[model samples]
Target: MWWSLREKRRRKMSSTHLHSQRPKRTMAQKSMKNPRSRSRFSVKTSENYIERMPPEVILKILSYLDAGSLFCFGFVNKRFQELANNNAMWYRFYAGQQAKKKNPRLIDEVTDGLSVVGIQERPEGYWRKQFFKELAGYNANWKKKLKAIHLYTGLPSQTAQILRSLRVRWAVTLTDGKGRESTSEQTHVHFTDAAVTVSWSAGDWPFIDQLTVLKLHGVVRVPLQCPDEYKPGWKSLLTKVKLNKDVWKLCGSDRLVKLLYTEQGITVGVWQEQREIAFIMVNLHYHQLVERSLLGSCVVQYQPAEHTAAFDDVDPEYGLHGYAAHIELHSTAGSIASGRFSQLFCTKDQISDGHLQLKVISKSNRSQHAPLCGSISLPWRTDALQGQIEGCCMLTLTVFDEAQIPFWCVSAPVAMTTSEQAEVSYDCTGESFFVRYEDAEGKVEIELRWMEDHKQYFMVSLIIFLSISKVNKHFGRDYLPQ
Candidate 1:
């Protein structure tokens, strides 16, 4: 009986010890019996599930986010902070934004990596800076946002011919009645015998009934047949004009009723020569708004370049056909230090080529200086030469200094057909044609003359007028402050 009792007690004690060793039901497991408690338990366990995901997968997910969202996401955690600040990622993001631009295919085909505005490469933090700049520019209030006002007019056959010969260009400035003004970022105008385009960027807006002013500087003149009331404003070609409240109402109410509104912006075409302006179109919203106001009246048809999606898309097939020529730069006048010439590049539309590295051969080498002189011969019909300028309507030559900065640039139309070659009767002496370009820096004249008969467009001469101010700026001091 004792042995039986002892064995039973031992078995009971062993069972009790095993039960004690087993873990008690956790609070979570105890709550699992209830549906709400089970839901709460799951919520607490999966909080760090994304942190457990593979880094590449997380990045791929984040890639779909915009710049603003990406910036916000950087604050999520340290690991995310590192990924969001990746330069390569931001570059790709910026490139993707560029791809979404209008006619990106053509832009890519022509410029390669060069932007139309001359932005060459994506530097570190450029993406963020551009993003913020665009955001600020586009989202500013009506008074602060950039406004573009375009004025179209017709040129007589005689006036157009004179403009072509003089190579006239216009620079315009817009100031609101309040005195705030903004210069145009880009003044692109394709001058032909028929239509002339003029536009300005407005920084401040004039309220209704205020006098909006336009100050323009150019050498071309159109006959002004203004009413007696408006005669006070019309003067020289380079003069200011103030439009009053009555003229504003007349412009938009009667004449410019048929204004065109497209996805790009609002455009009012007035074919009347007597009409100074048809309407004042202001881009108030992001899309743009067209306000019509008639200045004067007459009907004259004019043909500008073939209107396209973009203004500068003059000829998509320009320079596709091959032509052979020799291009040379000559120092015609003024003085520049020796060894000033470093590189020469030619770009027109989408075509660009680095022509040569120039060496300035001077008669004397001293601390003083000699005539800004250098000659570089670019053989256009060679295996090494990739671009041909034979059929191109226009081309731009940019000369770089020793520091690889643009020292001088000239954009001029090429002498292509016999008509163009004959247009400049004065300059087209023999089988030679000349185009001249002048700016605040200096003047450059390009002489495209034939050598052996008229079989080939043989050679080009670029003569630079080294103005004192330009030379002084190039050398980094006021050497000659004219």
Candidate 2:
């Protein structure tokens, strides 16, 4: 399919591309009138100096040429063609391009693990060709899908989720505007700090591949029923993280009015006694309370690798009590899968007395046959220092790995008056593990530099604080801030 499609496209391009761009009175097109005359353009070359150079030197030169330039080099001559199409050249291109992409198919194909048919007996230029072709196909498909589709817009996060829910790739469990669970069959939902994407079986969602998302909605082939309002609601993207019974004491389960994720951060709307919804934004990066208006604030937390949030911070010099998060474990670590990690956290607080209980879990931490390092019960508890805590708070938890290691740590802010929580998840098998942390407090964000690296995985946590935004009092019933 790849070879055939590539040849067909090449034929199409060769027939009309240069012809359409060529001028009518070009020298080459007019040359047929004087075939018998050897016009006057002639330069006698002694030998092909380029081919005289060692092949290794030629390959070195080819390495500097990018994908486009390399393909163009093939048109120069036979030697250049062979050098340009060399496996070494395209392999480097393939490796580099694959590193930037989220898809693993290219890597699998080159590594002899490709599941696709007719990809086995490929030549050196095969990967390089596919790199451009697959990209072209993917982008073109998105463009076609995006043309004239009417999506629920405004809040970018909500828009993405709405489109995802409606354009199913997999069966998803959704609660409609009136709070009814989605009964759609055979669906899967996935989440990350930055995006929430849902996909279901192709057979289930007939028009899913054909559906398009418009960040700014306009005209559409099908009439979409969406009201022009800030429609905020709960979207369950993380399969592993759930609002269990323990944390509900802080924010009642019934009070959660809405949940959505934006590029900036995750925001929530919860019902309050004042007959209004509190708009709270939780910054997952830095794990600090970024914004809140009216109601209680929301914090997003994931179980940390090093149990850094487990520290019991108690200093004799200070008045209030809270714990800081981490102490480095090592400069270099082993594989990302099934191993222990060290995470650190530093927290500052005003309220004085409360024990923080954290629950830790991992969706990929499955190792039934692995040896039991130790028997352990998670959602561990820690108390503030002698009920009298000080300036900076740092906490660390040492979790024993029975099999696979836990990836994130979740805990309540030690002594804050109004503590609320939200769940954040990431696609762990990514090339860039850590997502940028956004400061919700309108403070300058300092650049963090790390010396070491590992396979891409996510380290996400939430920061929740009480809202200082005064209530918006309209002439009568209610008015929420935009």
Candidate 3:
């Protein structure tokens, strides 16, 4: 009887388990939970590229960047900083910058007090010391590294504040003392300057290449793009630079100014106050850098632009010459005290060409400060004139101050290029001012405006030169004040 009862209970339990149905999942639960059981899908993405890339790959990539870029990159992230600062990496950079030799293994450059190696080994941190030494302006092998300096925009103290990095464009032409010339290499060194960017590079990579901007002190890297905020100001700064190309401002005797690049060579100027005091015009087409080179000796010191020979004749097609009439001097305006003036006339080619005669006129008349009357002439198109040519002419004038120092000088550029606009006919006269200076014909201009401001600075009567060449019949205009 007990056995029969157990069998019935077991049967009842088995039936219940076999026949019972499971409950259906709700829509919310089904949507929220994984569709498949034991799924390994994750919502997060893995983008740690540095962690993914092999260190050898990273190191091979950092070989192409400049030294300044490498140093700036040292602040990126711990990994990047470490990779950028690696001593081996600097060895490659120093090697690339080194002068070539007859033997691939032997080098003349004395880095870290050692010559080239032949299967020899060096301690770690050796290249790092060598890099810093190059920057310290040592290692005379690269002595021609920096030939000229240009003060582009701001003071050196303001470099970090205004620029993203101090982008140094350095090119050296190697030369031996015996006058042998060599084209070395080009280097663009960038450091923190506020105006542009506060970014750094891992030098330039050898193979892998892409522009990048890493977070300031963060590990996340972002695509480097120019800042929108600084673009307009940058454009304006460029315009300002273009306008004040004449000035070579001398700040101090011993210290050199900042550097700016030009197509021909380097120009040194102060960005603020619209000034440039000195410039070293080097024709790299013919010259090389060395301790005692002809080009190095002839650094173009800052003289009043017009007073100097108007030497920036970049194009043979266009030459600079201009004239002013209706002269006016205001005692309360700028730095012109009592002075004497003289003028010279020469054809475009004759100015630079040593063969032609520069028929200069002398005027030693002493003039008082106010209403300092004078007449000036620049030939319009002098085909009939015996000496003057049509294409261009250089009009040079000298102004001696009360102490006979050449205080005010003019070497105005006049365009006589035979275009339809370069008619023998002159522009309207008695406009109180006239100047045409451009690759093409344009009226009125800048260097003169700067000279006016210069006079205003000294709190003396500013000497005014008026241009009415049309009335003067293109020979010379008399000083007529409106």
Candidate 4:
């Protein structure tokens, strides 16, 4: 019995020791499976985490940000600072923003820290004040680039002088005042001041293709030289002569002897008059030639209907008669040969009667003295033809002495048609006026009522006015006082 009790006690002690050691073995295996867990357990328990990405991808992201944001982000790291200093990146940004609008101040700020590759920094207020000064110093080592210059009217002469000193191969001046000439390539200058004179030597200004002198003083003389290619010939000659007062006297040339008037000399107004004379000459010559060519071959046809008379009420004040003539060419031949001819002349009394006579000649005949067609006399009185025709066709009316020597002519092509009529009516008190018109085809009628206060007229027409007129009319009505 004593030996059995000892054996039972020993078995119970061994079983308790095995149970205590089992928990320790399981914990050891879990720690070995996860090293990270063991490290976290050894340190403190926290959720703070930091991730690192490639520097290149980060830079690309930064590039999309604006200059201000990119500037601030540059301090994020050394890599970013390098990117921020890149000239190309900043240049692209500067060009893009500048294209959208002008912002010189913003450009200055962005390029302040970076070293620009090909461009140099201009001094402060360079564009506003010292732009030309800087441009003048820049050597002409660069290729010629076409540039347009916008000059202000009120700029001081010194500024203009500085601009003239620049290496501008070609320049276009946009101002009302006179511009100084540059010793460079051809320059085209436009001005609103009509009285401004452009004085340049023909040889020096060889590049000048066109010179337009706008409304100028009646007495100002512009010295112009014909180009070498356009030297005097049988066609026309260039003569340098002084214009006394308003009269332009051909002093140095004997060619204009026939065109000379009394001591008053030939004025510019006379040249304008000659244009009309030339047209009348063309018409008279054409009609005369046609009559001579077709005289025996074809019978003469006439539109004998009496035309309504039209008159300018102010003609007497201007010492001009309201007389005119209309002639049409119905050519059997397809084309008229081109050649120079003498001036067209008419009897001094032809104005009162509205009579026209054409000098006829054959193509084979080249003499200035040619046989004439029978006189064309229209019996229509001034009052009978009122509002009967379209606007007057361009008629060259030449008045000469009985000897047929050309004296004075007026060419005013009236843009009138046979089927249309124009009538201008004035109020008795001269306070209001209106115009009525009928189209040549008689398909349309229009009436325009004058609004004296606004200095405008309202037209009732078949066509529509553009959108601008609608806005203008709306504003005009709104602004008119009740």
lDDT of each: 0.37, 0.30, 0.30, 0.27
Q: For residues 1-482, write the lDDT of model 3, one tens digit per residue.
A: 99999999999999888677556677556655865632334323565776679988877777767566666666667778778767656675555446343236544342546444621256555676664544333344332333322122111233222122212222233223343433222222222111111111112211101111111110111112333221111000000112123332221121223323232112222222333222221111101112122112122211212332322333432222332111112111121212222332223443221221222211122132122122222111111211111222222233222222222223232322212332221311111222233211112221111124223211112223223332222222232222
lDDT by residue (18-62, candidate 1, tens digit) is 999999998887787788877777777547887889888888988
In TM-score terms, which candidate is top? 3
- Models, CA RMSD each: 26.1, 28.1, 21.7, 29.6
lDDT of 4 by residue, 54-165 (tens): 6556666766875446545545567566555554444555554543444545555644354553433543222212222222233332212212121221112232222234
Off by over 4 Å in 4: 1-32, 35-51, 102-482
Worst 10 residues of 2 by lDDT: 327-336
The regions of model 2 sitting more than 4 angstroms off are 1-46, 54-56, 103-121, 134-482
Candidate 3 regions off by >4 Å?
1-43, 52-79, 99-104, 107-110, 114-482
Residue 52's C-alpha lDDT in candidate 2?
Answer: 84
Candidates by lDDT, descending order = 1, 2, 3, 4
TM-scores for all candidates: the values are: 0.24, 0.19, 0.26, 0.17
User: What residue pairs clash in candidate 1, if any at all?
Assistant: 250-294, 251-292, 251-293, 251-294, 252-292, 252-293, 272-298, 279-293, 336-372
* Per-residue lDDT value at 233 in model 1: 18
Model 3 lowest lDDT segment of ten: 231-240
Q: Judged by lDDT relative to the true structure, which candidate is superior, 1 or 3?
A: 1
Superpose all Cα atoms of candidate 4 onto the true structure and report the RMSD in Å to 1 decimal: 29.6
For TM-score, candidate 2 versus 4, the one ahead is 2
For this target, which candidate reaches the highest lDDT against the unseen true structure?
1
Alpha-carbon shift of residue 371 in model 3 (angstroms): 32
